[model samples]
Target: MLHHWYISHHHLYIPPSMTIHHHHHLLLLLILFLLTPPLSTSQNDTVSCPLNFDLLRRLVGSNRPSIDSSTVCRYAQQALRLVESDHLRRTSSFVPPPNTAESCWTAYQAVSDYFYPNFDLRRNCGFQTNWITVPGCMNITNRQQFENKISNSSLNAVVSACNQSLTGSSCSSCTVALSNLQASYLNGESVGNLTDCRAYPFIYAAAFINQLGPTDRGTAVCLFSLSINFSKSNNKHKTVIIVIVITVVIVIVLFGSAIGFWYSKRLKKLNRKRRKKAEINTVSALDSYTGSTTLIRYTIEDIKEATRNFSRDNIIGRGGYGNVYRGVLPDDTEVALKRFKNCSAAGDGSFAHEVEVIASVRHVNLVALRGYCTATTPFEGYQRIIVTDLVKNGSLHDHLFGSESLRANLSWPVRRKIALGMARGLAYLHYGVQPGIIHRDIKASNILIDENFEAKVADFGLAKFAPEGATHVSTRVAGTMGYVAPEYALYGQLTERSDVYSFGVVLLELLSGKKALLSLGDGQPVLLADWAWSMVRNNTPLEVIDGGMAECGPPEIMEKYVLVAVLSSHPQLYARPTMDQVLKMLDMDFPVPTIPERPMPLVAGIEDIERSVSSTGSAQLSTPRGYQAYTFEMDVRLASKEEEEGKC
Candidate 1:
């Protein structure tokens, strides 16, 4: 009966005597059951011992008669205890201990080994294989993809529970735990404890049973234990490789930092050397102008501090030369600072030339040069700055046509006064100085009005001295387009007459209240000089007068002033009056000179003359009586035609 019972239970036919002799197998099984530990009382325990014996019986099968049912029970019991203990430790009410994620992952690996001892975990587990290792489980390579998968799986509930229960500090502790697990797994270490492994038993069972092979149950169990040891050996090798990589990275970072520091220091030293060289050049340049007692030398630092480091708000004007900043001196004197544009040798020459010219001249109508500065700083390299008196009323161009407020204040008498003051200043520049100076750029914009409504001619950057016994200085043309005289613009022959001609253009602009260059809305620009000349030639000089003028004194005086302006701006350089004669005409010092007939060749328009002057600074001259002779020739030809018709 005992042999029959063994055959029925084990599904094997064993002899009665063999069963009697191996009766100790039952006793050994009993002892094994007695040695197994009981389950913990923790509420968070995931596995309970004494698992379904029927399920274990089916999983092991009756292939080996040497192994009894008790051994299978013992192995299952041990695995359950490990799973239960790990779950309890992980879900403990205290703060998470170190290596919690690693511990959880190892428990899951152990469960996988128990279920599928000889099967490849990656192949058999399908998508569930990642749960066997923390690095693979976490999907560190693509976190969003992992998250999306988790959201669609049963594991989502576990993640939601952790998020809902954890505070910010606890969450950070959890993150550290996960990071440690990932690091260990990357080094091929098996996590010893994994709390979430309890949830994957069903998945593991499904994959394990699908690939189960007919094998000895004892050997299968032994292989699972050996795999754990093998994993540990591989973990040590991976750890060594990881350590070497970290050390190499640290050494490289230290070397790179040292190189960066050395490069920074060398760059700073080079900048210091360049700055010192610039300062030396600046000092040498200023020394050349020290012989002049009138010129005051200033340092770059002083100008910067006075102008608030050249702030945009301090800028008063901008032109082709550069920006004009309003600044205050150490002596509490307000001044206009003209910072030049170019920093080349040509710019330096202009700066030095201007200093020499303004420093020598002393006239009320001319702008006073208070001081000068040459700076070569690291930021603004080799700068040339000129300081002049800050005119309160701004430029003549501003008052004549700028804003309505300015025009309202500038009465006709004030305009006449400004006109006379400008004439006096130019006359002084032409005749009062021994060698004389020709202001090549004489326009309304350059004429500044003072606090007392007096005119002061500023910007001597273009001024040149007329040498003794020389009629004109031949040089490159440099002046505003419409204001340049025909002789100077065409032939590059700069003379006192050229300046007189420019003044005449300004005078005409003032009288007519029009810009020197006027856009006629016909794709052609007309010169104020030509327009005034045409008005005078047509016997309508008063028509050219600005209607904005309130008190023009007398029509006769105004007309005479207009006639003098026209005669001074004649196309023929010889026909134009001198600065002295211009002043006399403005003051009614002598009768207005006879207005010459319009030169027929000169009637080609100002635009044409400008084009010709720009190309070659001289125009082809016509005879003094060229216009009269042409008219006479036309009349004689007409008379001959009339006599022929009468004969016919």
Candidate 2:
């Protein structure tokens, strides 16, 4: 016919004009046929979860029988991992789709093959594909809710408790807590078929391990295996267990005794070496100073008898350095024995060498060293001991601002005398010695009061001696907060002036009956120096004196003492007077100078503080450095630029 065209299985016919276009279409079809993948390969690539044959083999152990319902969950977990890891493992160049899934048949087949010979694990053990992410009891509404609930539970704490210790026992509290967590939140009670309920613990462990550490995974997996404990009750086995236990105990006793004996001998040898080293350092340091006081070496037994085995009742005072205990010496002398808490070998050397510092100095106003003892005991380690005459009154801090019963003992005259005595003691350390000793920790607590209420400067653990002709020794800053001088606190440039600055703070404390560091209304710390100076600069000097002592002394005398304290604690290092100069100021041998108007402290971190200061005019923040209190000052930098310029 009419220009006949035919399309058949083997042949196609077209009119001569359209024959060229037909050939092009046939060529395009041939290219696609060559590029297309085989059916099997495409099927393999499409399966979201591919269970490696080797991984399945490892999951079902060779040692065990084909699993029960509880055991089959372990196999289910291995199959579930492929899905979870895919979520983390990328499929394309970098970014991937947020979620992925697979045919339930894929998971079912691999998990079935895991127990290879017995492939019908579901019928035998009642396992299912949906049990992958959570236990059967927790009926989750959505994917997000499931994730949120598990995350909120934070099973780490409970799981950590169940971690087996060296003794091969786990925390009972852990078991109880975990049980409660399951009951309350996880709905751990069997609510479904018995087979699914049996599968819950294993699935629960699998979900929890994904969130926990690797070390905890082993413990978590065994939770159910260990929990399935069966108690065998038989009279015959009870006798056998008791006999086995006795034999094991006997063997362990013999082995342990040998180890303990060897350890004790080794410890004794090490302690002897430390004791000898400490002695040499003590002798060498003491020999250099040719003072009249002798460091009498006492025995450890004598010390123990003196302090009644270091009884708690005998504890007279305690500080950051050590505890001071009251003891009666064999010679019928009452002594205060300072037992340092530092039992380390390095600490032994320090306290040993320092025994000569305050011990060698003989002054009525200074706590003289009666004697010192260094001994080693099997139990108490190396004992570095120092003996001194006991001061009946605890400390200047005790009477002036200590407990109420102690505070009553201090009248205005007594406070004045104590202040004078403290100045004398510090003066002796600074000027009386050939090489001046800087009492770096010169605070009210360090100044002990005797029966006569005389203040004796004590606790020379942080003392440093000025080298000949050196103005300031650049050393580590060691002192209390609210008392450290500007140069020493910021730059660690220490000198005799650092001690004077501390003394000034103590003097201020004595006058105001306020602590050197005062906590304000909002728990902000205001230094006594700042508060006292503010009153004196405002012509209300009497306000700085203790309200109780307001009428005890002439207002003029009190005002003079207040002015001297302010002068001695001046922020600038050079502006601070030496201890000798301070002594004369207290004695009125030198007149009180004109009061200086203190500007905002131009010390370290003041700029950051100025920037951080809010509308409230005070801010609590960390210190750039550390001292006693652990926090820096806000009152120190409260004044603004305009105010500082106006006051200065």
Candidate 3:
């Protein structure tokens, strides 16, 4: 049997499957292969590729006025090095960046100067480009796409066969696998390119190595670097042993260095955390001074100094989750700083939500956020604070029920203005805003009063945004007991109407100068909502007006305010008027809807409202377009005054 032989680059290659006896005859084969002139074949047939040095040397020698082959080969070698340094590079997988076809054009032209003027090298361009663009069939940019085209087992086999450290049968297997892999892509179904190009084993290895990472590139380059004599692979004992020993030493040093690096990083991280704690513990106190008035995220140190280190004397208002301090900022601007009591994650979540809501809204009737601070320290744990412009007259609750000294003789006209201002604030939250906000904690305390007694709604920590087209958002109840709507307080069913109900309770307090929960001789507290409704139902609405007002209003106006409050705080969910309706009724642009008959059990908890709602099955509530009363029909005895003023 006869076997064909070929000289591939400097290394002579034979099919791994072919067995040759008496290797001494191989010398004759090499002589015959090099002595033969270069030849070409069709793309499908086996094509003989030239050696890198020999290809350039032969081109120069083939010229009529033959230039030095050695000088031309040197230029080609330099050109090959520049190709790797400049043209071939890693790129983003999503976008395949432009690769100038000129890169291949330039490398060849760099060595083409030695050719005879009449004999240009353009015809051998494709063959010459293949010299540097080995394994050119693969697309490195779309790695996942390229890898998906080949089977996993075949790819793994190819990788192992082409390992740089391997030789002999390994090299033969690699060559065969590479040909099959290369041929597989030539059927017009490849990733980067579909057509076949002639390439020797060394050039083929260079193209493949371009796609590999550093270590693999080096190892694989070694595979092509070796001029392996298949018959004599076993004879390179000293070389193989040296390669194995070097690989082992390099790996050991790498592993030891990696372990040391990991420990170093961990130690630095621990030290950083420890240093942070120390810094917080020893943070120096800051001195107060006038500075720029521009609002910014004030640091925790700035807050402490401004509030006199949170002295009790500085505290102006106290609430459920935080305390408000009357502070003079560095700019000499007066601000009410609220420092939260709870520092847990849930508190931070609420703090973030409050900031989000406060930041989104901007209205004259709403408290403006001057600045806020969030700090984490070992001493205070987590500090969440917000600063707002200090209301000159304090909160509505302070004027209405606070000590007499805080009260500035509020006349009925001023009271009415305050009432209208509060209505406008709640109205904006309900109607003007998209996905309206529900001021869940709409009570006297959250209603701040300015020097002109203009109401500014404050404390949005308990507020919730009413989603568009949503009837209600069921959530855990989060409002003050007296101000909380019956449905939300009991069932956790929240809606914009819940805020309307809370607003009604606040309205009654403003109109009557009474607390939301009016305490009688009995231990049970009565809802001011029921008491006002009972008085109005008895045709004695004037009795609900606050007598302490500087001046009394017209009977009709007083009666109208009383009627609006009763309807707004109506126990039945559908009976209560919305803030928009309340505003219209307050301004007397529209008549107050008839007082909805609240059921007898006024002393019951929020659960009583649920029962009242079920009783009015499928009853849709609607407001009159103008000065006409829309009446709600109900059959029930009104709760006694004693019962109305009992437990909420």
lDDT of 3 by residue, 1-648 (tens): 666766674578675656556254776777876787656555345332211222333322332223233233332333343233222223312222234233444534544554423223434322344334433344333345555666766666667666454322233345546555644542332333212221222233334533442223232323222111111224378588879999999999999897997899888888767645643432221111112323357788989988999989999987556688988887799998988775543334556566666766778899988777767778887677888889878888888888876554667887888888888988998888786888777888889989877899998877788889876787865666567665565456787778888888888998888988776676655678877876886889989988877788888988888888888887556567678888888986698754533422101112222334454311111111000010112202112311221110
Tens-place lDDT per residue, model 2, 1-648, is: 354565444445666765677668866765665566545555556435432334333433342222334334444443334323232222211111212123443555664664445556455556543333232344432334434555445466555554343011232234334544553455445433221322332234333433432113233223322111112347588789889999999999999998998899999999879857766665565545434556677889899999999999999987555678999988799999988665555565457546757765779999888777766678877677788888897888787776777877777788889989998998999999978899888888888988888899988877887798975687755666677775566456787888888898999999889998887686866678877877886889889888875337877777888888898887545356678887888886688755433423111233233334442111111121222233253223322311221110
Q: List residue ranges in candidate 3 displaced over 4 A.
A: 1-295, 405-408, 601-648
C-alpha positional error of residue 427 in candidate 3 after TM-score superposition, expressed in Å: 0.9
Instruction: State the displacement of the C-alpha of residue 95, model 1, in Å, after optimal TM-score superposition.
Output: 99
TM-score per candidate, chains pooled: 0.51, 0.52, 0.48
lDDT of 3 at 597: 36
Every candidate's lDDT: 0.59, 0.60, 0.59
lDDT of 3 at 320: 55
Error of 2 at 483 (Å): 2.1
Instruction: Write the residue-wise lDDT of candidate 1 on 493-590 in tens digits.
Output: 77888988889889888888888877558655566777788899889998878987766678888888889889988765646778888888788669
The candidate that achieves the highest TM-score relative to the unseen native structure: 2
> Best candidate per lDDT, number?
2
Residue 562's lDDT within candidate 2 is 87
Query: Candidate 2: which pairs clash?
Result: none
Of 1 and 2, the candidate ahead on TM-score is: 2
Candidate 2, position 485, lDDT = 71
Q: After superposition, how far is residue 646 of candidate 1 from its true place, in Å?
A: 70
Model 3 C-alpha lDDT versus the unseen true structure: 0.59
